[model samples]
Target: MNARPLPSLNILTGTEVQERLIQARALQAAFKKEWKRLVETIAKTETPFQSIGTHEYAEELAVREVEQETKAIEGKAQRLEEITNGSIASLKKDRQRVGFMRSKSSVLTVGSNLSKDAGLMASLGVWADDFEALWSVQKARAASEALQEQLDKTKEKFKQVGKKYREIKFKNQLLSANIKLVENQCKELEKYRAHETRCKSKTERLEKSKALL
Candidate 1:
């Protein structure tokens, strides 16, 4: 069997790569848990508002929609994790098979003289070729898996960053709205005080005019 070259796998930065993988897994799990929590929250929210009419129904529906979307995302993330884990297992099995075939080939070639036992040697060659083919396929699968895993991690990272940005943006908006409301209230109070002072001054002037008359 002609040995094929293994591709270089230097993309990973030692323990850092493992750390990222662990973090990704943890995040995936967290998302799943969060999804469940969201579902529960939605259910609880709905229960209280169920007796109300369409407005409350609409709010409940919106909550359910959000929960559904979250669940979908969590499912996809978990699926990606499963695919990566499966690929790792497949690669390990392939490696073992490759090693076994190499040993078998060495043992067979040592005793079989191609000149005297051409047919037998041909059979061994066929076996070696089969093993080589399987090994090549396994190698390709592993490479594909590695690329996919990297892509999944990148996508997941973006998802987390986006979520964080949205949360901060929402909080900022709420704060701004609250501040505006307070400012409006202050303005209204100031106007009321000014009107009250004018009324009091006009009343005092009328009293003085009546007393003089």
Candidate 2:
């Protein structure tokens, strides 16, 4: 028998898995927002650098803030990804269990039908021939059932692996978006550094001119 579709199996337990995925996406968005906030904070702070004491101290503070924010985002993203993956695993296991139970049901059904047929044949005085034929049929049915059970198990395993792969895909998307934001932040930071340098130069030049006056 052909295996039941795995995607359809996901519907066996709906909404909960989708909710978990939604939450994961939310966390990813939060990470993006936090990163944006950090960059904005840096941009705002950069505008005030001329009077912010030593240049080293200002740069040090900016570096520390970025590091802290990035770490927080990474930690949150990691946890969210784990949660999503765990939910997917649970769904996969549940589907496999259901499939196994159905396989057992199929076996029981076949056995019940065979026994009923054998009893009818015996009552009709065809006992000798029916016994021989029924016994062989039972054996063949049992063997087929066992093989189908094994196939079901293998299909379940593949489904579990596929679910895990889907989770990985989600993580990759999040990482890609985060990386792009980081690159943009780096460019912004460079601009801040360059602007700070120009400010410092202007300040020093003005001081020198005042001394000569």
Candidate 3:
């Protein structure tokens, strides 16, 4: 995008430079709005596997969207910084040209010449603002990534707790089965004890009847 050379500051008057500064400030405002929205989106984003056994795809999609958005913002910040640097360099070069002219020229006109230098200074100020705006966005993205890392850790803990819950549930089921089996065996042992009592009573009765005879 920056392959073409920018027009030198010599041709641009103070009024025209002021116009450019306005545009630059407006661009910075837009960046601020975008940064605010990005922070909001990061805050609203949900993590993958946050829910138990559901919404996996939806959560994953949300995470990917956040990642892509962050990457795009980061790209914009880098590009803006590069452009701002180029603009500052151009301004400096123009100032040098003006200074060299002032040294050789005897007239040393102040009105137009001073306005031109003031305009260049103003231009530099706006570019600095642009640089600052980009820096803020980068910082915000860093903070968002940190928050995401914490969320991931929380999600991992949730998964671990879920696994432990399933393990406990399985153990409880095994304990219930064992208890039922023991109850059934106790019923069978009770039946055998009753049969032994009946046999002892029959043997005693037979012995008494024989004595009577």
Candidate 4:
């Protein structure tokens, strides 16, 4: 059966991100514990097939059990990797947008200041010889007021972007932590699978020897 599509990270709010991170961490912890238990169980299981009848069956069953568990863990690791990658990509895009907005706000502030200075110059008759001083002052004041309004709006937008950037950064850190945990779990599972392979090979050898006898 086809799996349900994963949710896009870009649409997640801060709370949603936190919730997902928590769930991922809990799953990671549970998987790690289960994996360790499996390894210990496998290690403690006797391998010599002392009772030729039941021991062979038991060995076969244990191998099959471990193989199933390994497959499950591998599947979980793949899903976690996909989630982590999506989160990282979404956060990177948000950071870039915020950075751009901040830069644009700064430019707007500078422009506002220049407009204000022009208004002051016009009021002082700086261009009176070429233009009507009153009209120059009125025009400059209108431009200054418009620029100031735009600057105010830009500043507000900048504040919003800053807030969002901080939130995204925090979520990114949580995702990074989750990714690390999942990666470590995957590595441990890999080691267990390798050990399981050796056990399977040894079991096969023993079976062959028994057949020859």
Candidate with the greatest TM-score versus the true structure: 3
Q: What would the TM-score be for candidate 3 when compared with the true structure?
A: 0.45
Q: Against the hidden true structure, what lDDT does model 3 obtain?
A: 0.52
| Tens digit of per-residue lDDT, candidate 2, span 1-213 | 222222212121234434544565677666556544544443464222122232224444544544454455456555545555554555455556556655655565455777767655544443344445445545545555554554455445434533544554466577667555555555555565566677677777877888899
| Model 4 TM-score (2 dp) | 0.31
Q: For residues 62-124, what per-residue lDDT tens digits would candidate 1 score against the true structure?
A: 445444545655666566566656655665666666567667665664554654366456557
lDDT of 1 at 175: 50
Among all windows of ten consecutive residues in candidate 4, which has the lowest summed lDDT?
47-56
Candidate 2 lowest-lDDT run of ten = 3-12
Instruction: Please identify which of the two predictions, 2 or 4, would achieve the higher TM-score against the true structure.
Output: 2
Q: For model 2, name the residue pairs that clash.
A: none
CA lDDT scores, all candidates in order: 0.53, 0.50, 0.52, 0.51
Choose 1 or 2, whichever is better by lDDT.
1
Give the lDDT of residue 209 in candidate 4. Answer: 81
RMSD of each candidate relative to the true structure: 27.0, 29.7, 33.4, 31.4
- Residue-level error in angstroms, candidate 4, position 69: 59
* RMSD score of candidate 1 (Å): 27.0
lDDT of 4 by residue, 1-213 (tens): 222333333234445545665787776565545444443444454321122122215334444544454455456555545555554555455556556655655565455778767655644442343234334444545555554554455445434533543554465457568767655555555565566677677777877888899
